[model samples]
Target: MRKEFDLQLDSFMLHCDAKHLSKKTLKSYDQTLRLFAKYLDVELGITDASKVKSSHIRLYIRYLRARGKYTVASSDKGLKVNYPDRREDYKKDISDTTIANYTRNIKVFFNFLKGEREIKENPMDTIEKIKPKRRQKQLLTPDELKLLFHSFDLTKFHEYRTWLQCRLILDSGIRAGECCGLKPEDIDFRSKSILVRDTKNGKERYVFFGHKMSTDLRRWLQYKDRFSDSPYIFPTVRGTQLEVNNFKLSVRNAGKSVGLEVFPHLLRNNFAKYYLIEGNGDFVTLSRLLGHSSVEVTQKAYLDFTDKEIGKKYQRHSPLNNLNI
Candidate 1:
């Protein structure tokens, strides 16, 4: 008797949980697999994991490409309440990037099923990986940064904390989640570096800062000590670890106030861009600092510099220009 799709999915999720994957990753896998299971049951009446075929998977991909966002809900209850503004992009097509992600999640799930001996053959093995068009990463300008930073009300504790978080990301190229996970003990004043314990890859690494950031960090620490004794370096007023979403919202609103579009990740992106283009830094050092698995990953991300940025980099390294010929 072949195992039911939902039952095998539950077992796979359990295995993933035991491996200590990040909450975001776990949620993605769960959501994608559940949706795929639902599609299989409704479209093909196939509930057994072993009965799924490559043709069924290809049909599902076509279905995904043809579908619109928010067209399907896990349950029928409160559909109107959940999506109140149906007029607002109710029929917008799902992006290629999202479809690719769903396909990847499905492939991972099928691979797990095969590995666990739940299925003799992986249905997704024959399915080609969906390649989405790479979108250019937007770099924040210096003028925009100045405006966004100044928009924050430094007198307020929450705003001050968020301002410092933004500064840390821009100065050190640390992710927003890593910034939220910081503890006072992680900071090494002597070395001007931070020990990032909670990272995307689950590996600990050191990210450095400069003298200006050092001074600001000291002042922030002194002020924070006077008010709260939260274990995290940056904490909410209730003395709890600040959530990444809250920090993201704060940064977004700050940008809105200054009439510019900004997000926490953009700050980190600017850090990498400037580190290479302006600071004349190399890929290997930046890769290690950013805690990438390898130099290739870092290069793939930061190598999409615009023509103007390339020209600026070229001018600095122009051999004849520097040789005074």
Candidate 2:
């Protein structure tokens, strides 16, 4: 009556699918569990979920740290490295953040197995969650932002669209994925807000922009109608929906032209930082605007303000500094 690890993993995946998890999330769980299964077979010659112990899970974490980017091929589950040369090129150690993610996924899987009565004792019960160190988020400076925006050639529709798109993200604090998912019907010009129907968590919310962004959107929409009658706010030249990855690449290249490192999410981060530090925005409203589950989640992500940013915020609110004493 030995329960196989692979069987348990498959059952867990089916459960995840039933819960209507995102494809990206399902794929991540699949890859992580497959790797775990490979470890169970190759390292301990233990394929049964019932036989797994907390010590084995700890050893796997250590192995992840030592192996770096190297992983055994799940097909054969052999201990040998898959691509030796490729590992040399990206020789950085496996990040604690990645390990923590893997640990979380594994815990979820074990919890599922226990609920299904597949495992009597969940080995991951005692395994503590890995708390990754939060690195200070780097944002684009005013000069860099100016340079990046100016680098775009307005003559080209694609560049014009990209510029507008970047500005929209910075102004609205919307996720890039949600931005790409926007449609013509989503814009509420009267309210100066967008109806993000395809949000990350599947909940609809409104994200607002100022007069400047609204003006730009109107102009872009008028220009866009001349060439293509696509439903999407930002569409490919062929009038198809613009892919998120391609948009990200365009953002990256634009930053490179200005001799600055940037990405789509950086713009969103800048939105949060600017809203909080400069606009004197509160966390509860900011959290809802960012479409996070709660204000606490928003606070955790953005609480790490640099000393300079803190000093600027303090100057605005300091009683002795603000009021003549």
Candidate 3:
């Protein structure tokens, strides 16, 4: 339960719930709003929403930066649970992408209050996020891929099942949620295609794989047939939809055995990078396959090509490289 000191928070949360936002979005907005309340308690000494000001809201943002809340972790997923950061360590920092989200939500909250005549001015109206620097995409190399695949035992049931899971992600580039949500009905054997329904951004699309993925999926399901039955193409040990955390644990174990990286994010990144380079880096098809809403989003996420490979491209991206990136 949230603390009851702030009326603005109570009203804001009520409005958000009335709007019926998704759970993921609800959690995010709730966290940002809680931070705002904490900021109010620290700086403004105002508990009531009616007393909030443009100045207080602006100061809240400044407070976040001052506390290193806006700093991206030195590495993603840096710290573990049950550990406290030293005074110098501070809050485990969020990424620029994350900071942008918080800023956007805060703006919306203040705007809503303004619309309701609860505030004289919207302090978040003019605040902007620090644009994140373009970071290089991390993808597995050919040898690394070999290491990942060949490291596992094909004869073992659990090992084979995990292999199929990794293969599907690398080949399809489907979101992690889509992977868990997939059902047997989603695939058509004759068509040799899979239809992912209502994926990220609520777009449905069909993706087909060549012999490698199709054959692996079929073979693995055959092995799994003796153990249990479930509608899900990939089911948990108890025959229900597999949870995301379980999948991650299996992938990490497989990677340790293979002496290669095999996490979901890396596999997904490799999928995009390979498809782009193999298809002459066409963003439109790549975007669709990856379930990205726009070509720009795809471009911004994947940048794993070697300098020599990038230089060979006909289109120059920068003066230094004689091409555009």
Compare the candidates by lDDT and give the number of the best one. Answer: 1
Rank the models by lDDT, top first.
1, 2, 3
Q: Please provide TM-scores, in order, for all candidate models, with all chains considered together.
A: 0.89, 0.86, 0.74
RMSD (CA, Å), candidate 1 to true, equals: 3.0
Candidate 1: tens digits of C-alpha lDDT, residues 1-325: 5448878888989999898887778888987887888888898998877898999989998998787877875556646557624645576888889999998998888889888887888888888888888777787888888988899889999999999999999999999999998999999999999999988877889999999999999999999999998999999998899989789989988998888878998899899999999999999999988889999999998899999899999999999989967
lDDT of 3: 0.71
CA lDDT, every prediction?
0.89, 0.88, 0.71
Name the weakest run of 10 consecutive residues (lDDT summed) in model 1. Answer: 78-87
Q: Summing lDDT over every window of 10 consecutive residues in candidate 3, give the lowest-scoring window.
A: 70-79
Q: Report clash pairs, candidate 1.
A: none
Give lDDT tens digits, candidate 2, residues 1-325.
5447767787888899898776667877998888888788888898877788999999999998888675455565333435433544354688999899888898888888888887788888898888989889986789889999999999899999999999999999998888987987999999999999877777899999999998999999999999999999999999998988789989999999989888999999999999999999999999999999999999999999999999999999999987888
Which residues of candidate 3, in runs, are more than 4 Å off? 1-23, 38-92, 115-117, 153-159, 256-262, 303-306, 312-325
TM-score of decoy 3: 0.74
For candidate 3, give the lDDT of residue 26.
70
